[model samples]
Target chain A: MKLSIIGVGLIGGSIALKLKEKKIVDFVCGIDNSQDNLNEALALNIIDEKADLEDGIKNSDVIIIAIPVDATRKILPKVLDLMSDSQTVMDVGSTKAGIVESVKNHARRSRFVAFHPMWGTENNGPKSAIAESFSGKAGVICNREESAQDAIKMVETIVESLDMHTIFMNAEAHDLHTAYISHISHITSYALANTVLEKEKEEDTIFQLASSGFSSTVRLAKSHPEMWVPIFKQNKENVLDVLNEHISQLKKFKSALEKENFEYLGELIENANKIRGILDK
Target chain B: MKLSIIGVGLIGGSIALKLKEKKIVDFVCGIDNSQDNLNEALALNIIDEKADLEDGIKNSDVIIIAIPVDATRKILPKVLDLMSDSQTVMDVGSTKAGIVESVKNHARRSRFVAFHPMWGTENNGPKSAIAESFSGKAGVICNREESAQDAIKMVETIVESLDMHTIFMNAEAHDLHTAYISHISHITSYALANTVLEKEKEEDTIFQLASSGFSSTVRLAKSHPEMWVPIFKQNKENVLDVLNEHISQLKKFKSALEKENFEYLGELIENANKIRGILDK
Candidate 1:
């Protein structure tokens, strides 16, 4: 397989490295707007060569879009328009509904697969790519019925080569579930980090006391705004719904504390501990 | 030094293991309300022997209270009443103000040192005790001036033996700082886990989508409420203040999302990212 990856950043670079590691792709072509990123990807040997979109499309068996969701939404239709019958296009965008909807009416829609490999870190760029980035994680394929059987199979093959479990769901359900499980986590982390940063002026103190569960809870706060802002913008309604629920939960905790209702607070924490059964599996 | 550890659970058990590994304690006697925990501690070699609270105190030169904050508040004075001038008492409770105040008027008040080791995990019991648990973490000693120099030196030496950096603050300041840096993190994580569990009915989906980030963000939700509830109850006012601030921050993000104000959301995230400077240090 010849794989062409757009963006050439964390997700794209990771997929390229993983595919090359698995010997699933004979050649990888990177198409990135940032020449510096392309240069870094080349220096890291993440891709065999660099090419423009047209040249990348003409030369590759598969094209993977791994840019921010808003950018992916804008460029997906053009990429779909340029797809050939034998070539398949897949996306690794965090938000699927907007990107899937953007190309819904394209004539070559069946040649495109809407995918979200459920893996990422706060770190970014080609330098942060890992061959095992997607290993043991889920890869969501939204609106699988919309894609042709061959295109779906090709994307599934890629997901399998990356050692990911495949999950098929509608675009709406995909966005909603991710907002509950993934997107809300980032929002909570960011808000928690800002809360500490805002209230606690002692930087050295936070550094010293970070190990007491603060570090992991705030780890996602370091995520790049360039990646997450577009996700929040594209999945506004779903993110808003979850964020509202999260705020209400925080308020419930606050009120319990205010009323000195230790029993109620304990019950809330006990209820929350139920996630252990699900997450530990 | 001889050591007696009350409540041979996660915190207590871990301290015993690390002290034994470092050969800082010639012997560690275990005392807990639960016979099963005491038996497990003995069987796991986390403690040298089992003793009642009175027996443990009489036989050891130093007593370490590693119980929940509420339990610590109730038992601290009793332990202090039994202490000899040559003996010292230290606590590893998450909240300090309540525990410190509980023994403030005791005749042997100067014999007690209030300490909070800035380390923990979701796991519990003797089997979960680890030798390297406190390494590279901060150890806070509250109201250091209240304890005698010998008592303070003994606790600080124990902290150093565990390879932790010592931080000294008054009881009020210790409680307040922990509320911001540690206690609120657990609340956020528990609420986050509960939020996802309440909204997303599909447990299988959460299991499949448990990315490294999601797993870490919700890790503290797996924490036993038995350990956390008393901390929240004891540190009610400070935890409430930080929780309210955290809720307000979450509301800001929610409002931004509801208003489709991507720019504001981006700014919030960028501001949150400033935590990297403090945490990565």
Candidate 2:
């Protein structure tokens, strides 16, 4: 099988490397807006060749879109229009509702599958790609019923070859679930980094005194704005709802501290500890 | 030298285990209000024997207080009252200002050293103790001038033996700095965990969709409330100030998303990304 990957950055490059390692694809062609990334992907051997989107889709049996959500919304319909009837197309963006809605009425809608691989690092670019990055992580297929059975099966086979657990959900539920679990974490981290950077003017002290906990909490702050801004924009309502809840929770802590209510504070912490049962398992 | 640990929990037990592993002290004694903790410490060989507070202080050349910050405030002066002229008393509490001020007027003030080791995990109890916990973390000795030269030197030697870097600061500075870097992270995490818990009703979905990023951001929510409540209470003013700043930062993101200010949101994320330079170093 031949695979064509668009926007060959961290997620795209990683999938390419893993599929090549597993021998699931005999050839992988790259389509990227940045020539430097294409050059890096080639030098790093992530793809067999760099081709135009039209040529890449025509030549490949499957096409995977791995760009930012806003770009995927803009590019998904165009790829579907250029695809042959038998070729399968999938996207691995963070948010799904907007992209899925954008192509809901395309003539070749049956050939498209919306997917999100639930794995990433703070680092980005082709250089950060690893062959085992997606293994053991969830891969969600949204609106799977809308796609052709053959297209859905092909994407499932790809997900399995990458060693990811597969789950199926509609686009709306997928967007909401990710907003609660994934998107809010980035917002919390970014705000935390800004809070420390704003209040602690002494950069040297923060560097010296930061513990493993602080480092881990703030690690997601390093994620690229170019990639995340589109996500927050596309998933604005869901992100906003969760953000309001998060702020309300912070205010409760502030009120308890102001009133010297250590007992109440302890109760809040104990309640939060319940997450251990869900996350640590 | 002889060593006595007042509370045989995670911090105390870890210190005891490390000290005993290095043979830095001739004998180590354990003192705790809970008999089960004492028994566990003995079974784990974290202490040479279990003793009453009076006997532990009298028999040991150095007594270490490793309890919650509020308890440290109540127990610090009493421990100083029982100390001999040549003996040293120290604490490993998270907050320093309140603990230091509590014993400022004691007759044995010079015998007491206010220390805060900048290391921890979500786990607790004697069984959670490990020998290498404090290595390479900062150990801050607050109000070093108040302690006798010999007492400060003794604690410094122990710190060095544990392979930790030592920094000296006043109690007020220590409390404020910790509120900004360490304390706020825990509050953010607990609030984040609760926010998700309240909003996402589907536990199975949350369990499946939680990425490594989400897990890392919320890991501190698992910390024991018995350990953190006192720190938040003792450093209430500083914690409030940082909490207000953190809330303000979150509000900015919300307003940006509400107004469709993608440019402003991008700018905020870019600013937050600056933390990578400090934390990754």
The global C-alpha lDDT for each of the candidates, from Candidate 1 onward, is 0.90, 0.93
Which stretches of candidate 1 lie above 4 Å from their native place? none
Question: How many clashing residue pairs, candidate 2?
Answer: 0
Local accuracy of candidate 1 as per-residue lDDT tens digits, B186-213:
9999899888988889998889877888
DockQ of each: 0.85, 0.85
lDDT of 2 by residue, B251-270 (tens): 99999999999999999999
Candidate with the greatest TM-score versus the true structure = 1
TM-score of each: 0.98, 0.97
The deviation in Å at residue A186 for candidate 2 is: 1.2
* lDDT for position A228 in model 1: 95
Q: Where does model 1 sit among the CAPRI classes?
A: high
